[model samples]
Target: MKSKDNFEAVLFDCDGVLVDSEPLTLGTLRDMLAEHGWSMPLAECTRLFLGRMVRSQSALIEAHTGQPLTDAWMHAFYARRDAALHAHLQAMPGALAAVQAAHAATSGRIACASGADRGKVELQLHKVSLMPWFEGRIFSGHELPASKPAPDVYLAAAAHLQRAPERCLVIEDTTVGVTAGKAAGATVWALCSQGDADAQHALRECGADAVFGSMLELPGLLTPPR
Candidate 1:
């Protein structure tokens, strides 16, 4: 009884969409960058790194600090970030309900595709008790040839789900993630948890097919096939 509104699979992004880990992640990164002489406000740090891998910003970091981005520095960042998230991370509001609805609607065909390191993604999901829903289906862009703003991770998740990208629904929170989902040919829906009109507009302009505030709205939006 599949209908136009139903998708064969539902793919989700990890940070802002499933767990409220962005602030912690960006905050840790901001403090670390300050130690390296690249201090900036939290908002500026977020604008620079949201939906992007820290390693991917090596050139920018080098440019600002006159120092190479080293593995030791990255490990330190990961260690601090993971500790913070393990202590304070929580699932986004209604995230479990949204995930449940997607799982049921697609008969368990769902995955988490994120532009983060595997360890970070797994740790956050585990801390928030969301690991079971994704488990082996978690796809990390850091493990692929390219990350978000590229189609690699979403495409990989869709392939693992044994579904065509066109038949998948990608739920993302950032414009970078939306672009990746759209590039993968999925129907991209953005979760604008902040309820910011500018974010909604930016997501749409970045190729999101739809944008809505609150994860609670997702279950209704993903209407079951009649």
Candidate 2:
């Protein structure tokens, strides 16, 4: 286990952590797929695409349907989804508070390590008023060689934070993210926004240092040991 006091920076995953946008985005993707005559259940769609980038999801769709999902199709889907997301999105419970608290404690070293493209992540954060909190502290996996379940994204965030991997704490909501944090040598705290006890257990098994039901509990959960 990582020593609690070892961490000097906090890295957050954006989608399900900073904002409750997963269901909305997933729904939009499902709708887009349906328009092309490819029907997919919400749960199944989420299972396949939840921590992946839009480009990767498009590839997966192409692979599954044996039909090309062109860049134009992805661009159209993202444009529509971004508009809806901007209109309807809100922060997850305690998300802003947690970010504030972590920033105060870490002296402004809180960073976002998201699988989202840089432009879209920045826009969403800006829309929700979380942009300033992460100013100059965002790391997009799209810029890295690999995404979650790989250590690149988290490592990049840690590097940008000027903190050692073992001295970074990652706040994440998915099993793949927990795995990636651990692989990057960071202690990971899993948030149970997905409401799946099985998934929470899987996160623990995959190496989350702790799990919390909501970000409201994260301050206490992240307190350093004396």
Candidate 3:
């Protein structure tokens, strides 16, 4: 994971890394919680849950509400989420170009490791026409023993791609994911275009190897710094 090393693979965190769907999800969650008389600012919502799994979010909410959410409630929430995602989803700016460049640079060893469920991951990638790039290489945090901030999923991705963890490169947009990538010994870069200073600092503290504000900067980062 050294800056001078040539990476064998590039692993992406799907939600914020590939698609600009975090805001849509944040808005949807905010509205859903408002119905239950829970008020939270959008910033706090993103800070708490952007790169987390549904199961974790459910547990947190249940802990706060002092009650467990039923399957029916989760089902309904996801149904609404699907609609919102379908309506607002778009690829991250320059994302396709960045992915293509990274794939070519790594000789086609790119995979998506996301905190989202496989279904949602596939749907969002397909909606943005990014499915072809990741076809059989999609991985979900839901399948891991523990989610982001844990290295299991990223490590799994490196193993499946037949690459050593230290030779893998990871692109993430959250401190949670950066922590996981660092844990797995992959070099990580945090994309913080949508975030403020605190977000940048968090990514650094979590072990991001570099930080940039845009996807447009990715191709440059993928290459060894001269």
Candidate 4:
């Protein structure tokens, strides 16, 4: 909404995009799965569940185990993983600075649209001092009828923020996140910090408008002069 900025709003995805919690999340899932008659490697878990919701994850697990995962089992998995993330989640490198830069440049028109539940988003944002930047503007994928790789969260966020989908720029760190952003008709900028040229190339194939290695590059990319 800034007179000078080009985009109407910046939509952010929380986990790898905001916090350095993807490793923690994947690690916890791997351990929890190992306890449940399967042992998923960290790599596989990241590939399957990064930027996805609990229900999608349960589907993967059920497919892997060849049996339906009970509601009780699914809830317990989330409970254990949630406890682990609550204890030690850190913001991504330059996350606070990038958030501040975005708001300063755009007149506070940034919002979060993540596959995480509301409680998890709140906790992670507060832990890293990014809460004030988003506050009431956070949109959870859990709030939608479907989560990412679907566009529901991003579309809902743009609606809530009073912006058109095309006028919002989405920041994400996974293919699922990128797909969701693009599906919502927003330009997606993927942060593929964990990958090399080949990996970043794959991200581009997933529909990232641009790809960068760190959060330090985020604010500049989101607010290029018109």
State which candidate has the highest lDDT.
Answer: 1
Backbone Cα, N, C clashes tallied per candidate: 0, 0, 0, 0
Q: How close is candidate 1 to the true structure, as a TM-score?
A: 0.96
Candidate 1, residue 79: how far the Cα is off, in Å: 0.4
Candidate 3's residue-wise lDDT over 1-226, tens digit each? 2257788999999988899998998888877776765679998887777787656777688766666778887787788888999988999998999899889889999999987788889999999999999998988888889878799889999999999989998999988899889999998989998668988998898898888898887887677877
Task: Itemize residue pairs with steric clashes in candidate 3.
Answer: none
Per-residue error for 9 in candidate 3, Å, reads 0.6
Relative to the true structure, candidate 2 reaches a TM of: 0.93
| Greater-TM-score candidate between 1 and 3 | 1
TM-score of 3: 0.94
Clashing pairs in 4: none
Order of candidate numbers by lDDT, starting with the best:
1, 3, 2, 4
lDDT by residue (tens digit), candidate 4, 90-130? 89998887888778766888898989889889888988888
Tens-digit lDDT track of model 1 for 1-226: 1235679999999999999999999999999999989899999999989999888889999999999999999999999999999889999999999999999999999999999989989998898889999989999999999999999999999999999999999999998999999999999988888888888889999998888888988888888645
Assess every candidate by TM-score.
Answer: 0.96, 0.93, 0.94, 0.91
Question: Comparing 2 and 3 by lDDT, which wins?
Answer: 3
Error of 3 at 29 (Å): 1.1
Write model 2 residue lDDT over 1-226, tens digit each, in one string.
Answer: 2235746999999989998889889899988887787788999888888887767666678866677988788789889889888889988989988898888778888899998888778987997899999898899888889988799999998988889989888999988889889999998888986567798888899898888788887776656667
Best candidate according to TM-score? 1
